[model samples]
Target chain A: MINDVWILATASLVAISCALVGVFLILRRQALMGDAISHSVLLGIVLAFLISESRSLPVMLAGAVIIGLITAWLSDTLHKVGKLQSDASIGIVFTLFFAIGVILISLYAGQVDLDQECVLYGEIAFVPFDTIIWGSSEQGLDIGPRAFWMISVVFVIVLASILVAFNRLQTVAFHPSLALSLGINVVFWHYFLMTLVSLTTVASFDAVGAILVVALLVIPASSAYLLASTLKNMLWLAVIYAQSAVLIGYALAYALDSAISASIAVTSGVLLGLTILGLQVHKIRLRRQGKATLLEKA
Target chain B: MQEWNLIQQPGTWELLIEFWSFEDMNALWVLMGSILLGMSASVIGGFAFLRKRSLIGDALAHAALPGVMMAFLLFQTRDPLVMFLGALTSSFIGFFLIDWLPKNTKIKPDTALAITLSFFFALGLMLLSHIQGLQVENKSGLDKILFGQAAAMTQQDITLLAYVTVFILVAVTAFFQKFRLIAFSAIYARSLGVPVALYELLLALLIVMSVVVGLQLVGVVLMAAVLLTPIAAARFWSDQLTTILFLSAFFGALSALISTQISYLAPAMPTGPWMVVSLASLFLLSLLFAPSRGLIKRYWQQRQLRQKVSEENVLRTLYKLYERRQFEQNDFNIADIQALRSMPTDMLKDTLKHLCKKQMIRESMRGFCLSKEGLEIATQLTRRHRLWENYLNQYMDLPADQVHSQAERIEHILTQEQEWQLEAELKNRKSDPHGNPIPENTEGMSRDK
Candidate 1:
């Protein structure tokens, strides 16, 4: 039962952190950038292992963030300077990075402990086993799951960054040129948001893996985009949606005896579908009311 | 390090020799499967690349995962046909969702693609995990579909891959022109009485089929590279769709051959990543070194143009200085030329030296003078410039002052035929709008020289 709580807490923290940064991604129309970074960060992890010869968390996070930035910068350069189409540039960059990561893993299969399967779907079920104990082994206090603590730090950081730079991020995301004219560093904010995204992705890697991290980043924010009229509301609503997905998805996974992370992603997708359906129904009802009012006047 | 040591082993040569000689039937089958998969994916992917839907293959591949899992759960078998059909059905549904969401909802196409891709992939993972927990037969290799293990492929898998790939290739060839039309301009194709919607459906089906079959080799994660990079590289080599299609197929086949050979030699190295990495290398090569459109070639061409333009501008500047002297003096130093038109001292010297090397200018103690050939060329340039200025002044209603800068750029590019047309349009005007004598059209004289 305690194991279940840690899983849900870890998943919710990951979802909220991802959705917090993802709202800006949606606002900037760069949701696919989230997808691209998630994939390419695999290369960073592999490279980090190769260089450091250790599986330390800081080294992996640093490597992943740096590669994530490079992925963003390189794709942007390919789009702008190389004159490749945006989607093709993104497709080329991320796939190439992922392929290199896979190759490195295969070539160094003896040294690298990571496997392609764990990198793809992740093993969220094992979260409770990897606990962090404070103090000495004799009387150490068991804090929580290591993943839960890592994600909590990331969540606090993300929440702090958003709070501190809310208007600047909002202006840059909505009107980049106007923000530039107003003396806000658009490029800085762009990378700032990208950094937040990278941090969130790396932190969530333990629970959701790489690809499904994109599901968490894109779906909740996109659903909120459909419903919320303001960025603040969208941010809050996205967090709400992400939390609910964790709760419902955990229950679903428990009932079906399936993977929790995948179930969470599925739940988020279902929630987005329901949001779309609800909006459509609301529109039809509103149109019917308009027709009724016109007919009564006639 | 181990990989390098293995490469140095004497046994590695025998493995390479065995791979090429087809001694190992498994290697042969995997090689054939990858080659066919590469060719067909690249050929069909060209249209998607051209249509700018390069990432749709990725979405469809992810969307196929659940279908594969569902097929396994339903049939309790791993029949290639059942898996293929399951993947195709789900991929088609994904295609429809990607097509529908952007049109009907406020979600942009990229977001729609992300949503469909991740949602389906997550759902598929869910189903796959559930299958993994169940005590089912042949569920062991089901996870291989995620990253694909070519060595695990059986002969039946190869046969199924062959049929699907060949069918895709034939369909693409049979409907080449129609596909080309729709890819380039669907609205134009529709106006010409083509049933664009039906053809689009056909194209989407072909894409999904190739993507489905390719899942067992290239896998889902990097399949988009196989579909996009070859065509992107091929684009640098050619402009026409036919040439691009052939070149992309060739690249695809070549990458497949190389990757399959490497995987057969190293066994631990997967075929899919090697294939994609080799393809990306090809893309890098084409991006840098392809003849006309490649970056290096374009940079070289631009440098040459800059040299030629600067050289001509110096010649024209020297001619203008000579004109300031009422055509008596044919020579002037760098200072005199700079007085008329400013240029860097070193650049002016370089331009003058190149002109001298071309025998268009003579270097003496006084400065530089136009040779007979150079004078004739200068006369022609001046005539074209002044004639353009006159034409612009008369037809475009520009003031005399504004025409010089406009003519300055047009003079170098104005062809002889254009000069004659401009002169005729200006009605044989002798003086420019600036009241300077338009140098006589020395075309016949320059040819004589």
Candidate 2:
């Protein structure tokens, strides 16, 4: 029972990292980029595992980041030169690359430690077994699974990096021309942010499957976008929504004895649904108040 | 060693012949079905595109996921009929939410689409995992539907598609006038006693139907392409109602066949991407060589216009030289006019012929001179130039000489109302500071030029 808390904490931490990075992705309107990157990362993860003969964290991260860069670069190039629309270019790149990844997986994945089932569904249950300890000079506290450590370190880096660059990032997301005119190094920063989003996503892949990984990256931030007026407020709301969703969803899954991550995803969805419904109710109340003023004037 | 290899290897040429025959048959079926899907989607997408609701298809495709899972949960099977019905239900509700949310709430459509897309896809994932845990018999069918497996399509798919195709054809034809009028001019359509709301609802329903039918072949991600590609490809061909409809059908038919053939050839590839490739190729071809709108044709037409503009500039320069006493003789030949402008000999001769046809300039043995009509036109043009310069200098606060360069582009597009406003603003200046006379306004000057 006590160990269950650790798992929950770990899962929530993973969710938080996705939500944190998602804030900017949603603001920049790169929501579907998450979906494209998720599918394309399969090629990277497979190549990394093949070369390393194991799931080396740094190697896998590097591979996934490379795939992310490829997806972004391919989409941008097609849009610029081929004169295709942004969404169409994104669709073309992901479908073709993902098909190649599918073929590769079908041919070579048969003999490896990986399988299509792991690729699509993911396996968070087995994460606790893959572990490492660090800085345990004292007899009591030690580190846990390498994924836990990876996500923890990543969370700190993402939070600190975003905190420092918040002003510039917000400016670029809203007023790209203004940011460029003011010497924001807009091109480098865009790629830098894409890299961070890719790293955070690959880090969360072990806990959540690819599709739900996409769900986390877009939903909470979009929900916050609806509920807030300013970028600062939106980011704060997004963090709250991401964590609260994890907690509520974990409890519901525990009660129902269902999968933890899947339930949390549905809970995030339900939260957005309820927010929409609440907004409807508020509109009706406001309309009623307006009608009352008209009646008084009459 | 070569002889031994030949003996060991079976001839793939004979095998290839057999494969090609089988592929031809399969490609025909795929093409027929793609035609059905493409035509219906375009007809439906036409309304959506006209209404600027193209992204609605995208939103609804994502919205259908959870509904599909819920249908599976209820039916306990991956039956196409049940799943599609369920998907349609949730997708409609998703649109209802998206539509209702903005009117009643603070959330915009972008956020609405983003949330619904993520939420429904997430819920579907949860339901998918649940279905897996229960060890459902047709679990693999779920995976096939997600990414699309066009090869596994059997006789049943063809039959269902044929039925839907007929329904869409009859329905669109029956409502053609109403749909067209509604698409072209909504207010006019309403005034004609058309059921505007019902027409819109039916349009949305058809779009959802097209999506559900194509989901088995294109999946959630690229179904919008199936809806968009044929129309986009056909847009290059013609704008006439009949031509657009027929050409879009043809394009859809062709794209589907190519995709289906590719899927058959490469068993590993999905039908959705093959379909996209064919659609993209059609659009690329259209961009290069479509009759009216192709890049090549536009470029050629622009070259003709530039030739005319350059000729006019030279003739105007010659006219200026005559005004400055360079060509003191009242009549001069084309060769003398060409020398004054320093233009190429043959090109100037060709342009001079075109000008003589327009009656703007005429040729004598001595040189070229402006016609009486040409003088009035040139004087009007010159007056506009000086007047605009004055207007810009006074209103825009630019230097008097600096305003001349800016008016070069503005003189071409300035409307009469705008010119009048400019004249009023400049207080009807009779002469430019350059000492050029602002020609007097004359009757029929406005109509002639």
Candidate 3:
């Protein structure tokens, strides 16, 4: 029971952090940029491991953040300077970086502890095994799973950043030129959000892997975007949706004995589908009410 | 050190030789299969790229995963055909979801693509992990479809790959014109009474087939690269659709050859990444070095245009100075030239030197003077500038102040025929909107007197 709580906490932290940053990405039409950064961060992790000669968490995080920034910068450059289509540039940059990451892992398979499978779909099931012990030796306390701790810190950082810079991020996301006109630094906000995405991605890597991080980032925020009219409501709704997905997905994964992260992603998609259907039904009912009111007046 | 040992192995040379010699039947099959896959994927990917749906291929490839898992669970077999059908059905469903979500919901297309891709991939992962826990035979190689193990491809895999790729190629060839029509402009094709929806379905089916067959070689993660990079690279080399298609196929085949050779030589290296890395390299090369549209070529063209514009500006400035002096003196010093127009000293010197080298200007004790050829050219430029100014001020109803900058850019590119037409249209105007006298076209006339 405690293990399941830890797993749920870890998954919820991941979903919350990703969904918070993902709201800005979807608003800016940069959802795929989130996707690109997640894939390419694998190369950063591997390179950091190779360079630092250790799998220390900070070094890997630093490596992933740097590569994530570069992935964002390079794809933007390719679209602007190289004159490639934005989608094609995004595709090329991430795939090349990912290919390099895969090749390096295979080349130094013995030296590096990471593998392609682990990077693709992380072993979230093993999160409970890697615990962080806190306090003194005799009465040492288990501080839940290491992934939970990492993601908790990330979730706090992401939430605080969003709260602190809510208006700036909103203006930059919705109307960049207007933000610029109002003396806001659009580029600074862009990289600020990208850094948060990178940090969230690297932290969440243990729970959800790289590619599915995109699922967590995009799905809940998009669902919130459909229902919420304001940025604040969207943020709140997305977190709520993400938490619901975690709970339901955990139950589903437990019953099916399947991967928890994938189940969460699938659950979020189902929620979005349901949101779309409900909205459609609501629209139809309103139209019917309008017709009945006209007939009564006549 | 491990890499060094792999390279230094004595058998490496023989393996390369054997690979090229086709002595190993497995090597031959892998090579043939990759070549066909490369060609066919690039050809179909060209259409997707043209339609601005490059990443949809990525989504569909990921969407194929669950279908493959479902097929395995039901049939309890690893037959390529069953897996292909399962993947095909699921990918088509994914294709429709991607198409349907944006139209039916408030979700933008990019978000829709992201949702469909990741959701389906996650569901597939769930099924795959479930399958892994089962005690089934032939389940060991099931995970290979994620990253693709080219070396483990059996003859049956090769045959399936060959058949699917060939069918895709032939179908694409048979419907080339129709496909091209829809890809370029679907609304126009619809207006022409073309069944655009049917053709779009056909294209989607072809794309799904190529993507499914390629799962064993390029895998789901990087399959989109095989479908996109070659066509992107080929686009830099040509503008014609047929030429682009041919070039993209050629590039695809070439990358496949290079990657397959490397994979065969180094057993640990996977074919998919090598193939994608090589294709990316080719794309970078084409982006940098292809003629006309390549970055280097475009940069050079811009540089040349800058030089020409600056050079012409200097000549025109000198002519203006000469005209201001009532044609009394052709010789004007650098200081006199600078008084009329602002040019940096170094660039002015270089422009003067270039003009001298072209024999358009002559240096004397006073400073510089236009040679006969230079005077004629300057006269023609001045004439074109003034004529454009007059035309814009008259026909465009500009207030004369806005005409100079517009005339400045147009003077550089206005052809001789355009000059004649402008002169005729303006009825041989002698002065511009600014009341500056327009010089007559002095071609074939002696001005030395």
Task: Give the number of the best model, judged by TM-score.
Answer: 3
Complex DockQ per candidate: 0.64, 0.22, 0.65
- Runs in model 2 with CA error above 4 Å? A1-10, A25-123, A126-154, A171-199, A202-209, A225-230, A250-260, A277-298, B1-31, B184-188, B236-245, B287-399, B410-433, B436-449
Question: How much lDDT does candidate 2 score?
Answer: 0.71
lDDT of 1 by residue, A1-298 (tens): 9988888889999999998898999888888888999999889989999999976678878998899999999999888856789989999999999999988877777788777777877778898998888999889999988888888888998999999988898899889999999999888888888888888898888898989999999999999999889999999999999999999999999899998999999999999999999989999999999999999999
Over A190-269, each residue of candidate 3 has an lDDT whose tens digit, in order, gives 99888898999999888899898999999999999999999999999999999999999888887887888889998998
> For candidate 3, lDDT tens digit of each residue in B121-181?
9889989888887888999878888877788788999999999999999999999999999
- Best DockQ among the predictions, by candidate number: 3
lDDT of 3 at A86: 96
Instruction: Provide the lowest-lDDT 10-residue window in model 1 chain B.
Output: B1-10
Candidate 3 backbone collisions, by pair? none
Consecutive 10-residue window with the lowest summed lDDT within model 2 chain B: B1-10
Cα displacement (angstroms), candidate 1, residue B87, comes to: 1.0
Q: After TM-score superposition, what is the CA distance of residue A176 in candidate 2 from its true location, in Å?
A: 6.5
Position B117, candidate 1: lDDT:
93
